[model samples]
Target: MFHFRRSTAVACLALAPLVAQAQINVDSISQDALVSTPESVDCTLTDGSTATCLEITVKYVPENLEVGPFCPAMIDDIGGIWDWDGDEAGLYRIDAAFLTMLDEMGYHFYDEDGTVHVFDIRVEGPTDDNECISGSFDEAVEMTMLIPTTPVMADAPVSLGTVAKVGVSLSGVPVFADAPSALDTGHMPALDVCAGHVDPGGWYHYHGTATDLDTVYDHAGVEGSCANAIQDAKVQFGYAFDGFAIMGSLEHDGSVPRDLDECGGHVDGDTYHYHASEEFPNLPTCLVGLQAEDNYSTNAAGGIGAEGKGPGGQGGRPDFAAMAEALGVDEQLLARTLEEAGGPQADLAAVAAVLGVDEDALRAALPQRP
Candidate 1:
């Protein structure tokens, strides 16, 4: 529900230097590396609408390894711990609360039982010992999403509600939704300065496109700054679940286009594509194109997407005690706070104010009650 906007002047200022110094790597990416053949599938939108979509499955690892030096230093700065137990076994860990929020939002992670867990810190790292804390490298995941062959706009702009995953980055990292689920309103996640962090599942994904490609380029032994690493001509970073291309902010001519819609989309020739912006919601804010069916649920055959039931299953309320423990708060205090604010019908901000914390923090801390 947060309306985000950025100063055009500031965006122009930040991009000008990068545009001049950075060059997108032309040989690094190819169509075959990122996308698969489009298949006709039935999909459902967030609004409970259904459509016949072109499902496109993509590799979890990007073709371009040069865009990621994703280092431990960056992770440490963001409060993430690698080799969490001090053993070199390569298990990563994050705040229990962060993991819990992901579950509440209906995103599932591989639990130790090989089923699913709501809050645990055992993240598996990439098999190849790369500098970046890339997850599931040995058995790379193939994710599939539905997109309409013909683009269509919704009657009203669909809100990107507590989005779990947005799209995949060109480097093959998963792109998370804009707002930080672990924090309250107006607060942001402690992401690596490069705009990415390691998930509890050990997946190294992005929340935006503010990464410094130079570090990645240097680590991969490729030449160029992060800015110039992506080809300036095409600037295709990745693809949305909706099957449209996700491009950088600048056009082929080195200028930000002015004709983009709310979802950062515009019809380029006959093709619909999205542009990454220099704002809070750096990527496209919503799916302007048609969406595919819910693939996050266990019922979905692939079960590789983020649009399904979480560990405890959808609609079943979470336990307050477990929720309180995950948020690092006292159960009694949380209950009292909720009661004073009107029990199950309390306003989140009101409860947070009474408890002297950010609304988002309080929200993330609370269980998903009916």
Candidate 2:
């Protein structure tokens, strides 16, 4: 009896070469940056400043990949992948785990299908407002994604085989207190802590708030400089909200009845919930350590070592590099370059030169700054 398990998309890729006639084909890839045009939002800062917050955007279109059954096991009986991974029969489990992990690393996932399966993550300075035209059916799918602020190095003579893995880290701290002197450039554009995660390799990432969910104090805090070492890498992130929501006054005040109840307290129209790895013990291993923060429920990137407690356990976050391998993305070159760059924002020009794309184009591809 063939007791079949839902084969993860990553596992299929590893076995593809050995099998005949593979179905998934990542046809054409095109990208653009939304950095110059920031998403201005009214948000109050940790230091008590109410300013129009800026967000970046990045958009891309992937040509062909048999759209049917990308991950069949996780889909719901209704044939949609948005069944909240099948949690709480009533609520739509937004890929909270995936989104949280990405957000922890400064990335946001856009619900392309109006359901929760995220096609792409937003980086610092990146948002999602683009459409993807399917090459197979020429059907344009309207979707949203998180943007990045910097550029990536995928063009030119770069060796696809050289990339061994993509490393991403995310964190959220009071904008004023957590931001280091390295990221203290005056202009908010330059000072946007999100851009600090961009590298010459052009992969923009982040470790802050989301467009919808805001980081609150009751949750765990971000620790150390885990992001201080990877470069040209992508960071997952989202927008930060002050009180009950960004629109509310009394910044950081949990006084509001709903605010004290944590997000998704009563499940209003905008309420979103996701399962954490701890909650769904039956989830695929491939999906387990994929990202630090998955979305609304969990935090990612090596759990912060409680304030004043020095770096905790092993100093790294979830093993996304391993996940990248499962995704069939080049990891070797990715690893070496990041190891040498030290941090995402360091020496971006040189990194871009090495990757071979024009600096402008590279930055545009980044999800954060788009």
Candidate 3:
């Protein structure tokens, strides 16, 4: 149970600009051509046995091609070959020319297998054709370029309903949203959208994605992180990634952005895209930040729309079971506390504090103990 304060969230969003937020391209090639002399050649093994080999030649474009984010992963996906040995079927290196094509198309390398590998490539102008097979003479070949793989598929965009919990934090308190399986969107796909601009108290906030969350919090100033603390609050409950339902049934309705400056005191730029879910139920193309729904209100102790109940035994408070499940604690402990409360007022605030909820809301949940 991490105690999340507004300061923590604000600190994290300030570091967003420093992060690498670029998109990659692959599947594009720019090269002159491939030419081999004599077309084929004969090779002899250590035992003195000879075999026919093809002489593959290629000319690259741009002289230097950039490999996108998927290249390494794709190679690893099918299995990478370090040595220039096409001996095994389906193991072949794309000549430097082909790499240019992939780079042009935005292909990047990734290593999904959790194993790190290194690849290098050296580019040189075409010289004597004899030099092509020279490296094979002693089994020591000269090559250019070594490419490594990046972490691949660690996080995939999954529907909210399939995850055990939506990974998010609010006011620094991490709550699990685990109702995806039970809630049906009714043909409207829902996506959880957070305002990259303001906090629950209507303060300017930033940082919208998990990647940005880690960067901003760890690197930004404490004050900045505090402002964004509410951003972490979640509508879903649970640690399992599959707890919340994704609004997959959402439709893209083009609409102008609605300013939220009145609520959070910030002017977030407009946006236009597809969306579902109560948060950002309407896709505003002009104002991206305004499209977000204010899900952080649920955690306030005495707030009007707060979700979970407090430790006190009373009317609007959550049952011992629901509170236990939401907080990831044992139900018996809360149940016992409720019994020992003696009265609602004495026990309510204490219960909410322990449960990480607001005190006012906790008191509201408890029934008057006449």
In TM-score terms, which candidate is top? 1
- Mark the 10 consecutive residues where model 2 has the least summed lDDT: 182-191
Give per-residue lDDT, candidate 2, residue 366: 31
TM-score of 1: 0.48
Which digits, one per residue and each the tens of the lDDT, describe model 3 over residues 1-370? 2111111111111111222211111111112122122133443322243433222222211123221121232332322111111122111232333223333443322224422222210111113111110000111111111000110111112222111112222122122221111011101011112212211111111123321222223332211222222222222111111111111112223232243221111122221112122221111111111111221223322212223434222236556576566655578655544432211222355455556666675444444433
RMSD of 1: 13.6
Model 1 per-residue lDDT tens digits across residues 59-89: 5444644333333232222233221111122
Worst 10 residues of 3 by lDDT: 130-139
Candidates ranked, most accurate by lDDT first: 1, 3, 2
Per-candidate TM-score against the hidden true structure:
0.48, 0.18, 0.16
Where in model 1 is the C-alpha error above 4 Å? 1-38, 45-50, 57-120, 123-142, 161-164, 170-172, 179-194, 210-234, 268-271, 295-370
lDDT tens digits, residue span 123-195, model 2:
2221232211011111221112221111111111111111111111122211111111111111011111122
Order of candidate numbers by TM-score, starting with the best: 1, 2, 3
